[model samples]
Target: MKKIEAIIRQETLDDLKDAMLNTFEENPIGMTVTQVLGFGHQKGLKDYVRGQEVITSFVPKIKVGFVLEDKCVEQMIDLIVKTCQTGNVGDGKIFVYPVEEAVRIRTGERGESAI
Candidate 1:
């Protein structure tokens, strides 16, 4: 099993979710979304108006995570990349890792089956 974490622009969340749902079976994957603040090389800055400056320190980003079968990793990554790409800064990132184990709270099922 593998865990895929994709940090992307908030605008792309709906598209990403729809694409993933179309590709996977109902509830075959579990997902979570979080709001995060961050900055990259271009970092945010303050905007000045009427001789006053307003600090804008960080960029808003959406982080999406899901657990899926190892075999599904490549496709899932592709889907995310395609849906999230904006050809601009702050498109965000994707991280993948191996899962040691997973458990179903109600049934106590373990391993890939639990996911």
Candidate 2:
């Protein structure tokens, strides 16, 4: 199994979810999203505070992730990239990681079935 994590622009949530659901029709895909703040190459954003320039090192972003079969990781990443593209910086990033295990508590299912 693999875990796909995509940090995307705050405004593209609906579009990304719709596109992913349409693609994963044969099997249901579930994901979790969280609001996070961080900085990367863009170094965050600047704002005016009391007539003075202030640089904020942390910017808001949406983190979307799900654990699925390893084969599905690449496609998921591609969809995220396509949906979130804006031809500008801070488009965000996608990461894939190996998942050691998964468990469904209520059913006591494990492995791919648990996912």
Candidate 3:
């Protein structure tokens, strides 16, 4: 299995959900969505704080993550990129990892089944 982590612009969340729902052949996979703060080479931008303008090194982002079967990884990655791209800076990033294992506590489903 593979874990897909997408750090995307907060504004794009709704579109991402819609696109994912429309594209996947299987039932919708479960996901974890988190609001986070960080910066890249962009280092955020200047913004007014306490009546003063200053470089804000940290900015808000939405990290959407889920685990998928190996066969679905590439297509899902393409869907994510297609749905999330804004042709601008701070569009965010994606990360993929090999999932050693996963489990659903109540159902006791593990591996791909757990997903």
lDDT of each: 0.88, 0.92, 0.89
Question: Which scores better on TM-score, 1 or 3?
Answer: 3
Checking candidate 1 for backbone clashes, the offending pairs are none
- For candidate 1, the 10 contiguous residues with the lowest summed lDDT are 21-30
Q: Which ten residues in a row have the lowest lDDT in candidate 2?
A: 70-79
Residues 1-113 of candidate 2: C-alpha lDDT, one tens digit per residue: 99988888999999999998999988979999999999898898999999999999999999999998988888888889899999899999998889999999999999999
- Per-residue alpha-carbon lDDT of candidate 3 for residues 14-114, written as tens digits (9 for 90 to 100): 99988888887467776789999999967888988899999888989999997988988998899889989988889999999999998999999988888
Best by lDDT: 2
How many clashing pairs does model 1 include?
A: 0
Clashes of each: 0, 0, 0
Evaluate model 2: give its lDDT. 0.92
TM-score of each: 0.89, 0.92, 0.91
Arrange candidates by TM-score, descending. 2, 3, 1
